[model samples]
Target: MALHLPQAASLPFGSLTKMLPLNKTSSSVSAISKSFNATTSLKIQCKAPSVIVSDQSQQVSRRSGDFKPDVWHYDYIKSLDNNYKEHAYEEESRMLRAEVRVFLSDTVNPLQQLELIDTLQRLGLAYHFKSEINKMLENIYSVDKFKNKQNLHATALEFRLSRQHGYDIPTDVFDSFINDEGDFQTSLSQDIKGMLSLYEASFLLMEDETILEKATDFTSKSLRDFMSRNPGHELTSQVKHAMEVPLHWRLPRWEARWFISEYERMPNMNSNLLQLAKLDYNMLQAMYQEEVKSNIRWWERTGLEEKINFYRCRVVDNYLWGLGMKEEPHVEKLRRVIGNLCAIITLTDDMYDVHGTLDELELFTEAILSGKISVRHLGLRPDGTMVEKRQA
Candidate 1:
């Protein structure tokens, strides 16, 4: 993220007789000429310099995927309406979530409270009730739930969520699971719920957490074994999924998008909560797609698709990456800027890798740094030779 702006006397790419300074030493006229000759010599080493550049423009960037274009139509995406803006929908969702929130407040059983809290989080409704959730966790910690555990699932859930929210719950809280033989209690593996909780909990491990590291290994193996024994069981799909990507590591929007369907299938799932999640997810997707369309418009206006063919023209992927970084709907314009920046950076990487020769790269680097060459100043001749433009 270092931005260097150099001092300059000229604004076009050519054989520089002198270059003024911002960072580098102010070299004399002869020295500048020598540097220019050296750059020419570098390009001369390549066979058919412009031919190489042209050939490279035809080559695919290493990072470019061969995937086909996305099938999502803009009109179809824009047509999606989750009714989240309507008064009735909002109040209904709020009331349903309120039931869960009230349940969180009224419960005396720590296990019951933590289970509901965990469920609220996985359902993507926790963002609406951070204060209640924090208070609940603080109450759990105040009771010293970390030190003693009557239930394995409850204990592991507490430890995982505590650490996740930066509670500094030591990894040794799990030491009880290990036996005198320096291994997990073999009997513990049989409790499918406990094993699954520990399996998800293990993903919260930070660096040098030996106990959690071992816990991860233990839980993973146990869950796989449990899956083998309980084929086509109710928990089979969930157990398999947990092993693939623990909840902690999953991307938030993607998790919500996925959990909406999974939560709908749950036997005792709150219907209002499911509707809210679906509305929220669809609304966000529509916002993101709108931003994406703006990015496509920006890209097309630049005519980069026709002009720059060396890199991946993944406009949607660019927007998604920005969304992954910061997906809040209020920042649609910011996401658009980030999307364009991402796309240009990807294109630049491809240009540097194959098309931009050393001389061209150095010249552009120095020129760009020095606020020169605002225009396309370097062009390739038919025979693959560099021609520097002299601006009028």
Candidate 2:
């Protein structure tokens, strides 16, 4: 390789060879040392090339996250109160669920069955009826009842629900919706119910499904226009909600919370199902409330805030996890155990990754292995008794 350099530039070796070839000290290397120091001190300071900045680039970065820290002066969570205990609604909940199942069993039309399944899923009560729902869906798909309906709303509904439940339906079923102009039929825009159903259905598309890609673009525009024209209509809010976040992507608990309110407003809403849902939610929420208290207390007494820096308190993290493990009466006990485990593990991980020294780690390991670490303190104590403490 050929060396390239600016012709006027000087290299450090330019002087180094000159000095090295002609150096001798008169006073026992002192003169040579001084000369060497002086030569090296002649620094060739490198200047970084300046970058040009536009006026817009330096003002501020856009906000990346909306998370805010807890701001209360006292222990707001622990100091606050809840009055709920376990409910005696197990028997009642069972009865209501049985009645709803009876209602489902009596319904036979495929389209009607799909509507019930769809509504139950959206309402988040579908978890209770999984076996029955699957049996109905299986029969409907095996008989090819999906194609028996020509109505766009019913076809889209069947297509979406079937695909969602893991049945394979042809993407070509949607070709009927495209007009001679090679776009989604503009006349079909008036079918807002079908449009919304199609919009939800479009999300189930596979990679090569260009028809669904067009359907997504078409339905989005159509729905946005519908929202503007009929802002006061009953379906407007639903359209807006579905456009923002699809049903499959929503957290089941939050979806249930949102849907329960919507379900209550329906004139034909089943009283037993509605009552069961509300009671179930309230009782489950109370369990979460209890778990949150346990976690916050564990976090505080561990002195995690003083010991750790910048790590989140993680009370919310623990509670959300515990809420996901819905095991009823034993769930409270499980939550406390698991919440403590998570808090310890999280802080311990941060310590090992970021703040711990080799010496501190050695001590931590020894303490744990030797049983000197108590449930309350898990602290590294060398000269103290290795007491096998029971859990706090």
Candidate 3:
């Protein structure tokens, strides 16, 4: 669902200014003036040695963010309703999850098991089988056959998965693949899958690991050369995507969205797993839509948008930022808290960065430091009433 928001404006500083004795000559005011003068190098020449002239009457030009209006609209967000939220869909998802779990249990080959774990993670279904995955990885790590493996893809995958799950697999795991001159073997370039895996695994390198560093440079150049040589190869797309951004650094939800489509094109893609991923994604998307709507409503009730107009009005963007941090369905409360905090922070940041006058910002900072204003004070209405806090 697409929801568009208007460009945000500055917050109301009147209440903050009123919280302090603006007319009285206090130490705080002198300190603020000194700090501002030091930063701006303003020369104030006054006949009275202790008096400072105020510039409140002067017209001050404010900077603007020049940010465009939000793309997602409130009406569009409210209109979003997917059938995946139905009970029948949830029941079907449970059945598919069970089938996939059984498949995971039945898989015996080490390489296949690693591939399956990688697939589940990429598809964003790993959380549903956390214990099972941990058990599998534990068993794989305990076997300790990575040094004996001749297949570069298997070794690289094993190294990557092990390090990712907190197993301290060492850099020496790649010693067999490196030549005496301390470089990756040139013959390994012919194995595209292995090269891609090495490229991915190289990202897990720690400080001072020169071998993985060399592997990164080697696999990067090799993957580019291979892609140029075989432009129409099935693995070319995956290679190019990997070269752009390694899987280790990608966001879970976004990667799942892209990989699900790519997985559909794979020859050996599991039907049950594919269906489960699709259903799970849609269900989560629907829930996120509701969460965004709730946050937008909260924003409206605060009356901050109508009262102040110089900050970014990005309720949807803020919620999505929270989603990127905690994508699990069960963490709805944490997600909402994060979203609200992000919204408030963005508004306050814009005020300091783009809109607030020097004196006004100082007063706000002082109020915060003196404990005269709390986060709850941010929900104050134009009529001097408090907006009731919403329960998560």
Candidate 4:
């Protein structure tokens, strides 16, 4: 729960250079040179000096990532079925969306409106009501009026949502909660909901925002103390989750998956919102399954997974990464493109890290830099040998 900002680690470049296989006389270099020499028609020129292989015992040893086999197989992925994709469900979803829109527009209380907006966002339904949410946030920001200045939850929620949507809310808004000692009042610690709100909002702090810096320390400590003291409290679970990873940093799809279950347990949860979240999530999950299946087919067609045995077969994981980047259902094509690229990149990275010797890697890098290695010509054998793939 300690709030530590990320810092880049300095690599030991000097020591790394000493360990590189730059020696031209190394047996690995000779092995690679011999491998390249065997494929004369392939047109790959090795950077290492060629050595005549009098003995056939010499072979380049490849490293393995030791990664476990993927548990999600093609048949399992294809079997994933959800009724939410049907037209009947679509009509129901549309009607529920309309009802939610009315509810958003009709909410008169500013705090209630902010809470609703926050709920919509966490539930991953924000995209469906983007315009309405934008308009509501604009009115809220422009008015610059809150009935209760001392209300920490309202203030923090407003600050977070507004700043998140590009509004420059000043950090001084929390000054009222500070005492003569220039610290958040001790009494505020008793309000678990407010502490949680402020904890999340503090992440929106810009460079040199000392007030928020103080707020982060105060709220984190207060929330942690509350969790230790009241472990069985209803809000303890939430505080623990937020402390582990703040809402701002959580993955949207994963967050929605978690919040949907949590939202169901709420006493005052809206039935329409809960139903829409579940249906929408299922529909999107169905789409994701199909997209991953398509990408896996594409990967199989490329033959990289078969041609290169040293790498990980992670088509589903790559698709999940792509989904994380663009979760909107309408961006299926973009997601597929991202998934394909991620797959290629992952394979290439593993090749460089686990299989390729320094000489081979350097030659490959040079070929790439000189625009000599095209996708059509690039091929590798199981024995870490490069070969040319002729067009059929």
Candidate 5:
């Protein structure tokens, strides 16, 4: 990221002896010539005697090729560099500010906030966003008047983003995102995002595998219980498939979570899901390895697992999109390999879930149940929007 600059020009000079000659006898003339030769020798130092003085254009070319401009010396250069860096920072800050403005402009959810934070991180501006989110949290939490508001839950995005980054989010911050006056059902998708972030943060922020395992085990059980009890739902089949299918054909939650308690219980006993998830993770790791293979020496030198994990997130997210959760498109030319890596991981996750299902859950019982598993909701029509169906 360093800026390149050209070199300065050398001062002009003339042959000292040419303009000052002495009239002399042979001895004096010889002495004069010897002195002149000595002076010329000293001026040249170790350089070859025939070295050419550069022309204006040649000097320019030499400066351009062989030297950088002294950016530190020029007031304008220093000013410009500082201003540009600050401008870039401000541009990112503005984007985050606009995102917050949108959050405040209408009803939003923790999910949207999570999604936004994720976006900021991907865009390399999360640091600037951290302060903006903090200010919003403070503004909302400093008064009881706003505490009872429904829009508070929408702002939970700030709380979750801050919490996930281990950025000191107070309980009051969480309080600001919840409605004191209502039953707390605001944005379903955002709620899901908040729940997922909470689940992830418990593991992510802690960095203790034991804690993560306990959290994972608990979430697994709770999710399973929810799935098991909610049988005969359309989403069950979709959920079952998502748990088992590869990314390209995987189901969205509306289609996947139709069956209730199976998600919680069945996958635990089923080795297929565990293996599939592992396989998907491994495949993603492999693709990441290939990505860094050319720089394997560099990666080993730096111990860049954070970058590796970040890329894995990308793979998982892409798989989610391949399953119909369209994420924002990333257009870096070198990173196109990420899409392929995700495709493989998505398929593997589905296969794992499929192999891990309980015998009873695995058996498609729609015909035998005689509409017991069929959804009778208004949005059950095939042409209905997935978002509407999910809300239903």
Candidate 6:
């Protein structure tokens, strides 16, 4: 149960001391801020908007390629849909477990294993499946019922529900690792890698028409339910608009195609929709910036504040140098975004640990600070609107 994991140069896990430290400003970050301002201030050429004003009659005749088709090509779409329904999850799940087994057993070829890892990652199981994989790894080495295929599958399900992080695990499986405490780090590293893989997997799912459709349907239904529950509220419109606009405007044709395909396959509109909505909002700003870069004055007027906030929200002092990645424009921007994200995560995680190990709290915080989190009436508190309480 205990293996001395090669001490990874202690990763900056939840900071106890630094979370609320003094002056809280480092000189290095200040310099970076000054440089960032100077660079952004440089005069750059802007592009003109693609649309041109024309006569009404001519405009009527001129078809913009913006119209989304009500249905996809029936024949081809049907066959693809049938295939997804028949296969996608079962294949991905089996393949994922197999890949982890191979890694733990040290039986599979490294290159082949990595490819399998990449596939599971692309499929979006990387993180969810990983915690279970680590559990399985321990089981393989320890005394838990690995021979029982049902147990293995149960482990897989627990992982999906966020139980692998010690939520609703079987006592035997949980205690098995407790016996061998040394391998904990290796288990955790595997878990992290797995989560990373799932994050990538989500992107892969994002591109699949079938997956995207299921997600959208799910989001739409959730919105409908939310609205039904709340009779009338001003914020409802804003939330609804946020959900719909991204689905209609921000989601591209390619993603739409995948959404349709996914809908055909899974046909369930569960959490996928929320994930898609979040992804849409997060990526849209970047896409919008790229789209409007040509019109200098327009860019200055519309985009400057957004760009500044985007960077400001993400900037963190430690984020710039940690992880050994080189500093550059995009890197700097990404670091800031990640920093902002982590700050929110760190703050909320404290609450989660205290309140209830609420997985959605992390996801919700992720959504909120990333501009995706929305809340509605459970009722009002004395101070303000009744918001979902975090641990704090």
TM-score of each: 0.72, 0.65, 0.81, 0.79, 0.24, 0.18
Compare candidates 1 and 6 on lDDT and give the better one: 1
Cα lDDT tens digits, model 3, 238-285, are 898888778887767777766777787799999778878867876776
Model 5 score (lDDT): 0.32
State the weakest 10-residue window (summed lDDT) of model 1.
Answer: 14-23
Clashes of 1: 1
For model 3, the run of ten residues with the poorest summed lDDT:
12-21
TM-score winner, 2 or 4: 4
Which regions in candidate 1 have their CA more than 4 angstroms from the true location? 1-100, 330-334, 373-392
Give the runs in model 6 whose Cα sits over 4 Å from its true position: 1-119, 122-172, 180-299, 302-392
**What lDDT does each candidate get?**
0.60, 0.62, 0.73, 0.71, 0.32, 0.30
Clashing pairs in 1: 50-384
Candidate 6, 110-145: lDDT as tens digits: 323333333333223344356544544344334422
Model 2 scores a C-alpha lDDT of 0.62
TM-score of 6: 0.18
Q: Which prediction has the highest TM-score against the true structure?
A: 3
Model 2, range 74-94, lDDT digits (tens) per residue? 243344343223234456557
In model 4, the Cα lDDT at residue 34 comes to 11
The RMSD of every model to the true structure, in order and in angstroms, is 18.9, 26.0, 16.3, 15.8, 33.1, 26.6
Listed per model in order, the count of residue pairs whose N, CA or C atoms clash below 3 Å is 1, 0, 12, 0, 36, 36
Q: Candidates sorted by lDDT, descending order?
A: 3, 4, 2, 1, 5, 6
Question: How far does residue 150 in candidate 4 sit from its true spot (Å)?
Answer: 0.3
What is the clash count of model 5? 36
Q: Give the TM-score ranking, best first.
A: 3, 4, 1, 2, 5, 6
Worst 10 residues of 2 by lDDT: 14-23
Model 1 residue 287 CA deviation (Å) reads 2.2
TM-score attained by model 1 = 0.72
